[model samples]
Target: MIETVVFDVGETITRDDRYWAAWADWLEIPRHTLSALVGAVVARGQDNAEALRLARPGIDVAAEYHAREAAGRGERLDESDLYEDVRPALTELRGMGVRVVIAGNQTTIAGDLLRGLSLPADLIATSGEWGVAKPQPAFFERVLEVAQAAPARTLYVGDHPANDVFPAKAAGLRTAHLRRGPWGHLWADTPEVVASADWQVDSLTQLVEVVEDARRSSGS
Candidate 1:
């Protein structure tokens, strides 16, 4: 039986356009420019961090990120950052005795911010804490450990196909692709990626259904 549902943070639960547009506005960069930079990096199958380095050459991206984060320790993500479907779906899953958790490639404060928002996730884990990111085997190992759920019985849901669907499937978890974020829509037409996921959801309403369908189809 599937005992746990692990969700991606940024795009899976949070709305990307709002999140990134605000980020672009703060950095004094045009939203289209920022989006293109992100697309350029992802198009070549590179990590999201590469976008910043490419956008502003010769800058110490990591250092700048840390400095900004350190200065913004008090910053809280606006409620609007979250998708409307997130809470209701999480609530229903938890009510059904499924362990709902959040795990993502994110900064250290992702846990604090998520918790502070009073999100329904029972636990939140991050790449910062693990010192590793998704699409990496070590990260999935940590996810399995922290979740204390077997890979075969865990449902891993995320918006990015490269980092989420493929990797989670390789890690032996049931994979579900959420098709609402930047990466989600960007790679939607990629046949191999679409075919790889055990489930594809346009929204969390569909995501809830995917989980139930997985149980029935897999007989787990």
Candidate 2:
């Protein structure tokens, strides 16, 4: 049975509209242009941040991010960023006695912002805090350690196939590929994603039922 549900941040528990929009504003470009470039990079399996590099060639994206922070215009998160199903679904899972963790490839600031939201989770963490990011074996290893459970009993849920599904599965946890964000919907029907995901869900509410069904099947 699944004892722990670990979620990804961007495009999983939260929408990424503000993230790309912030970049568009920072680059002084139309949001659509940067959004289109992001889609293009995602289509080609390139890093999503490649859109920023494409917007301003030879620009140091990291340096610009620090500059934005220095300028008091870095990442921002509020309740508006979360999906509608996030609160109720997470609360219900916790109520059901399942451990819920929010772990993703986000920055330290984002982690702080998320904690400020007071989402119903056991722990919230990010790559900036852990010094490891997704698709890396070490990242999933940390997730398993944080879970405090056997990998087989931990479920790692996210929208990205490469970063979420494959690596988490390789790390021995059950994988749930959520079909919500761009990467989620775009690769939802791909054979590899279908094969890699132990559970393919469109929303967090549906994920609750998955865990419930698992419990029944396992007689837990």
lDDT of 2 by residue, 1-220 (tens): 9999999999999999999999899999999999999999999999998889999999898999999999999999999999999999999999999999999999999999999999999999999999999989999999999998899999999999999999999999999999988999999999999998999999898988999999999998
Measured by TM-score, how close is model 2 to the native structure?
A: 0.99
| Residue-wise C-alpha lDDT for candidate 1, range 82-135, written one tens digit per residue | 999999999988877789889998778766777778988889878987799988
In angstroms, give how far residue 152 of model 1 lies from its true place.
Answer: 1.4
Question: What is the Cα-based lDDT of residue 140 in candidate 1?
Answer: 88
**TM-scores for all candidates?**
0.89, 0.99
Worst 10 residues of 1 by lDDT: 67-76
Model 2 has an lDDT value of 0.95
Candidate 1 segments exceeding 4 Å error: 22-27, 70-75, 218-220
Task: Give the lDDT of residue 172 in candidate 2.
Answer: 96
Give the best candidate by TM-score.
2
**Model 2 residue pairs with clashes:** none
